[model samples]
Target chain A: MSRHATAEQLSSYVDGELVGPRLRLVETHLVECQDCRRRLDGLQRVVAGLHRLEPLAPPPVLGQDLARRVRLEPKPRDLLERLEEHLRSTPLQSTVGFTFALVFALAVILYLFSGWVERQVLLHQPVLVAPSEVGAGAAVRRVGPRSFHAEDGRWLEVGVDPRGAAVVAVDDGVVRQLLVFEPELEPLLDEGVPVVLAMEDPAGGPGRVLEILPTPPEP
Target chain B: MEAAESTAAALAQSDLDLVERHRYGDPAAFEEVYRRYGEMVYSLCHRLSGDPDLAADLTQEAFLRIFRHVGKFRGGSSLKTWVYRVALNHCRSRLARRRLFWRSLAEPDEPGPEAVDPGRSPEDRAIAHDEGRRLTRALAAVPVAYREAVVLFDLQGLSYEEIARVLGVRLGTVRSRLARGRERLRQILEEGEPLAPESSP
Candidate 1:
């Protein structure tokens, strides 16, 4: 108000944002001030010219065209790409992308680790073997009634019926082997003979008798 | 008769209601919005870009964006303002890239002549042809930020608050930009040539 209304003040006044005593004071100064009034007039003329410029009517096809294009816009499919787009448009773009990248990377790493975990379990755990399948040279220890612990750390449970045939159970499956246990061996099996059986296939197959060992006393 | 009136009233829906209906999978609601805002958005793009073809492209781009992001629109601003903001942002990014491309080629950023419409009467064309050209040149001369504020305020008739919301700037910043923009436009009109490009404060 002192050195003449600045261009900003005059513009604000034209916009009708200036109010109260400030508006009145500017009005009083404008009445007495020719230079400020001229500035105001110039600004008004520029604004008026802008307003007078004809509004361009879009082409007749514009609506349909835009609608068609909008309909055609491809939706995001990849979750990461969709998230990237969402983050890029938001204020938190920078941090969100990095966080999502880390989470995604961690998920991949955990998925890979799960496969390794299965292999590691297989490597460290004991392999089961049937007492009948064990060969004569194999090391065997009788640990229970009709059960033997082999040197390879496998636990095998062997059962023999009165007909001189034997069955072996290992890892939740039964391996039926026609056993020609000698007539003497059949009674020993009925009395709980501990024998190491080695199978060609551990999952389920016919196994050979390797050795019959004395049953260890139960502790 | 009463049922017909009610149906007609329902058809005459507000922008927000139409957007809501579109969100719920109403294709007609989306088409209605497209019809309502298409011309205004295209015109805004045309004036801001000073290129009809580019304006059409930007117009399509804006609507595509709106269609995709409609669900994300929280009702903080009026639907009109939101649409305008989307269209203007598209224009701003494109013009910026065009400016960079032109600058790389050492070309001045003056807009080309307005596209002539054969449908217009000779008299109307004769009256408005020069005035429209001069206004376009003056507008092109103003820097992008200031030009945007001046266009939205004077040409499009958005209030300062709406301009602020659209531009994501403070109220004071809007006033400053508008004032400086008007001054620059006046100087360009008086000089009959665009001012050299300068950074806006």
Candidate 2:
């Protein structure tokens, strides 16, 4: 009240927005303050001028034009058109567009990431071949008279020439290669038994099996 | 107050019924809406845009919009407020695009032609014409935000609450804008020039 009523207070007072004590304070100030009273009068005059400006009637042809336009205009599908209009007019459109873009970007990123992971797996991947098949089949190529390498980097190191061939098993980065001559040892391999090979004598002879170890349980 | 509320509610219900009828292919329903709101729409658009020709075009556009989307009106707000919102939004967008809406009419390149009012005597008509022209120039000089509140409240005779609903602002904002708008308008009328725009607090 001592500040001659801030503009907000004066404005609110003019609009009857102030109530109770705020109203009373402005009323008291208005009665005693000539400057504030004059300012209030100016505001009142402007409001009066505004009210006096008569509302202009629409051009005589407005209704006719509107009717013609409406006739020409396509009728909107109720809920869908409403929603579309709302989205078009409001900030909601940008938000929806942004959300769609975000989803698309995320999907593309996930697809690319999955493809990259698959390629990496293919690059380092090693195929497991049964030793019985590799040692006796065309899949094994002779690197030397006694050594052969499987197409997938599994080495079949044959110490001596046996009636049967060598087979290898690799799992969890552990490699097990066996040179099997007897068909009975094939069951041991199938049963997940581990074996070591004994070297042949200096002269040509068949390699003898030294010890068979139990295969560890899979983790 | 309760009677007024009931009347408003009844009007809203009638508006909804009108929309439903229009959707159901009642030819007269839209015409009825236009008849009810045509002058109000035209007046609002004219006052805000300060051009009768533009107001006419905007009025047609607004009603066409209403005609097409009438089915979407659910009567959440009064039919009048919804119409005002749509009309005002269209004016805002179109005018902003042209960058011509906020130009001041304080200094006219040519004197506006006299407005013919058969209701008044010659002297009264001349005085009203001059006054109306001056008032229009002054109002146009006001900033758009304040101009909107003043036009809707004073020129259009909407209640403070209705203005808030139409402009989608708080009631307090409506009051503040009205006060500041009137103040700025008074300054322009007194000084006969466009005042520097004030940032709204």
Candidate 3:
């Protein structure tokens, strides 16, 4: 208050930042100090000039671009709400329901066709009839490496004259037929064992397996 | 009349209500907030950075950041203070990264395009334009920290406490910065050295 006001005090005074005693002190000093008054005037002019400077207008596309970007973003809250709204409309609801029905019909058609495809695969490949299917009891004997004859009057051979193929022959009194199987049955084809060739599907490819029946030994 | 009244009502809504509406997915509320504060933010960036293009970019980035983090805006401070804080922080980070490069680039002194007001007398417009150019040049010469304080306190009319919050500095620091900034601006004007043209990074 006694000496000329400092530049900080004058600046704070011009900004009205100083309060109470400090404010009164600067106001008192400004009355007698011409140099400080001129300095305060300069600072005030600078602030006024800055305020008068106009702001640059933003680009016209800014708002539109921002809106588009915001819309494209996935809004988890709005998504459920929009879906519910869509479902409330009867036409859209019916259209969606019809689409689901079409998908179910296609699935049924594919399922029925799958069974036909399986039958075709069975006919082309060798069909292995179980030993019991040929007759209730039939004694079988191996005639060759890939051939077999059964007491039920059926003959069996490896359809393709391959070394590892399975052949189950049955010669029942009524009829005789040859049954060929895939190479996977070779391990189970034992002489004098009541083994049944099972036409079960192989996991890797189109093939079948042979099962050895558990027959009780004669006392 | 009804529409105007409704607009006034909307404007009167508290910042918290507007922000909450935006959080609840009200696009109009967010747009209203943008309309209310966008120009002020743009002007702050323009003064802080002498380059108009960088200012525009900074302004857009600030608003995008605000939109992204609206949920985190607790009502600890007024929305205006928080927004100014966001804008100033962005400007500071940008300035820090480009400080050396920005100083090295020298530009020719040229006034940017000024929009002439048809309503104002030619003499008044001319004087205003000249004053604006001089002020802008002088501000550019001030050190960034001081310039920020002066621009916010004097031009943007923020209180000392609000500036402290924005700059994340002590009240004393704000006072010193504003004082020094004013003095530096005055000296630059008195010396009559034409302010170097502002260059964008």
> Which candidate has the highest DockQ of all?
1
lDDT (10s digit) by residue, model 1, range B89-173: 8877877887731132123233333446666777756645555667676777788789889888888888888999999999999
Q: Could you estimate the TM-score for every candidate?
A: 0.56, 0.61, 0.56
Candidate 1 positional error at B118, Å: 17
Instruction: Report how closely model 2 matches the true complex, as a DockQ value.
Output: 0.20
Docking class of 1: incorrect
C-alpha lDDT of residue B168 in model 1 = 93
TM-score of the first chain alone, every candidate: 0.34, 0.35, 0.32
lDDT for position A37 in model 2: 85
Error of 3 at B53 (Å): 1.6
Residue-level lDDT of model 1, residues A54-102, one tens digit each, is 6777777877776666666664234576578786787654587888997
lDDT of 2: 0.70
For each candidate, report its DockQ versus the true two-chain complex: 0.22, 0.20, 0.17
State the lDDT of candidate 3 residue by residue for B1-201, as single tens digits. 999988645644577788778767888876876787877787787777766666667777787777777645767777888889888888788877877212322452344444456677877677666667677777788888898888897778888898998888999999999889988988888788432222200
Q: In candidate 2, how many Å is residue A197 off?
A: 87
Clashing pairs in 2: A131-A167
Best by TM-score: 2
Q: Give the better candidate number (1 or 2) by TM-score.
A: 2
Q: Could you tell me which 10 consecutive residues in candidate 3 chain B have the lowest summed lDDT?
A: B192-201
Q: Candidate 1: deviation at residue A74, Å?
A: 5.2
List the candidate 1 regions with Cα displacement exceeding 4 Å. Answer: A74-219, B1-13, B100-125, B193-201
The interface root-mean-square deviation of each model, in the order shown, is 6.8, 5.9, 5.3
